[model samples]
Target: MRFNKELKNIKIYEAGKPIELVVREFGIDEKDIVKLASNENPYGTSPKVVEAVKLVVDKMSLYPDDSMFELKKGLSNKFKVKSENIIIGAGSDQILEFACRAVLNDNTKVLMNKITFAMYEIYALQQGAKVLKTRCYRHDLDEFYDIYKKASPDIVFICSPNNPTGDALGKEYIYTFLEKVKEPLVIVDGAYMEYAGYKDEKKRVEPKDLIDKFENVLYLGTFSKAYGLGGLRVGYGIANEEIIKNLYKLRPPFNITTLSLKAAVEALKDEDFVNDSVKRNFTQMERYVNFAIQRGFEYIDSYTNFITYIFPKEVSSKELSNRLLQRGIIVRDLTGYGMNALRITIGTKEQNDKFFEKFKEVLNGY
Candidate 1:
């Protein structure tokens, strides 16, 4: 059978190589692998979340609450938004798919930067729509504003502490952009909000600050990054009642697992766990910064747990990444993002130390 016309052109997303795979392929001990590719909480999940998951394991045969009342209520209380304004997804990425279905079609276009999250383009294109992107490396809202008028896109994506790159969009810039572009639906991907906010709460584009002000803007948040629930795949979106209402229709029944839903509820209660992870990541990122400086490596300024270090022209990113992988360490290769760099997630102190030891040895060889 033939697929939808656009399905053939859509490329599947390439996730980071898993640690289990590394062990299986190279015959290394499972304990020796250091996975710094995905921006996961190396410190692990909250004890509260673990207990919640255990309590719900017996209910796996049962369906999760389709309404997601407790999760939404929890989010509502935390973000200070009404439950009607929040929509849950398997992950924030799934909510993004819902957003594309709500706004994009053959006649519409999605606007974003050339170097933001790749999923924005993937989702837009999958909806059989066009994607218009900005022209620079810097996440400048001014250029986005100029392009918005010309492109007249149906949806706009702004990824803060943007993935793979780690540069955050400033709050003042977001205010200006919202003031200028009031027509299109703007989705701010704040997947790293907790970590970015910890760095300087004043500088980040807070979703709570905007839900009351702009009907056209939607905030995308996830549990995968900071909460250490990447394996469970639960995330959410915040917007006006009308936008949430439209996006909700497209969601499938029993979309989230009971374990994930219950675990996130507990994760929300454990703010101290989130805060400690943020503090540790911040300190480790500074350590990585010093390493880059002392070794003369070009690196991107990061506000999240991951730091993108650009390789010297003399070195190949793929080769360097392969070199690290052989040593039981893994990092994200930036070739897909059109950069000669590696995005390394700042892990726990011991994990970070191992990554650095291998990194130094690899660099010395080059």
Candidate 2:
């Protein structure tokens, strides 16, 4: 049985451990588990989204609207983009796959931050394209441009309010970078963009402004974070009609489920709910910051729903993660990313309190 040679180089992406897995592994009660690993909305989805989904339960027998008319219209209004400028996906990552498939080839090269989303390199490798990284861990546009001027890669990814790290690129910096690069297709993966926008006005990367300004840019957004619909898995891309049209050709039919479409549509109408969730997230986030400060630990200033606490070289991040896991508190260990750190999602007040309690107990061992 032969596989593509690229498979040998591609490492599987590891997701956050689930509550059920911990229960089975450690004999912990499900209720005791507080999962802050996946960056999910600790408050859950909007009530209106739930009610709207329930109304569509019996309709699952039929296929979803592949055209995605209503959801597209809602997004069009929200982002001020035309329907032709949009393409929906199971997650923002799928649109990323579409973008990769549409452009990447064996001889092509893709560039991104040294430590951004794992899926960026995964998708690029799937198409046999070479992957390039900036010298720094975060998004450094000057370094990216230095590579861009030399490599002239086909696709460039910028994950604003980047995953794992939680820092965001400023609006002026992004616009300036986009202005310099015209040939390569720049993918701005704004999965946590809502949280960034809420935290600081200058950090917001408006898709409307991006598309209106440059045809070479593709902006990705998801219902997963602030909208609290991660399980529903509905995401969309906004770009020039040409880029969107090319991506649409690669999209499978009826990609999003019936309930997902309804849920996303209803989720859009409840802006107040999303706004309230973002507000509450930051309030809880401060507690984590203070905890890090009081403990003499270092952490990155974040604009997203999660925070990454950096550990000293002597401390074992793996052991800390294992200790927390034993206590039924799930947090992501960045060991896989070659960092001695842990990325923790800011949970609800009650959940965050529990994490601090268990986390303190675990840290005492070190």
Best candidate, lDDT: 2
lDDT of each candidate versus the true structure? 0.89, 0.95
Instruction: Put down candidate 1 lDDT per residue, 204-322, tens digits, no spaces.
Output: 76668888888899999999988999999999999999999999899999888989999888999999999999998898888999998998889989989999989877789999999
State the displacement of the C-alpha of residue 293, model 2, in Å, after optimal TM-score superposition: 0.9
Candidate 2: list runs displaced more than 4 Å: none
* Clash totals, every prediction: 0, 0
TM-score of 1: 0.98
TM agreement with the true structure for every prediction: 0.98, 0.99
List where candidate 1 sits over 4 angstroms from the true fold: none
Could you give the C-alpha RMSD of every candidate to the true structure, in order shown? 1.1, 0.6
CA shift at 246, candidate 1, in angstroms?
A: 0.6
Candidate 2, residues 1-366, lDDT tens digits: the string is: 999898889999999999999999999999999999999999999999999899999999999988899999999999988999999999999999999999999999999999989999999999999999988888999999999999999999999999989999999999999999999999999999999999899999999999999999999999999999999999999999999989989999999999999999999999999999999999999999999999999899999999999999999889999999999999999999888999999999999989999998988776
Sliding window of 10 residues with minimal summed lDDT for model 1: 200-209
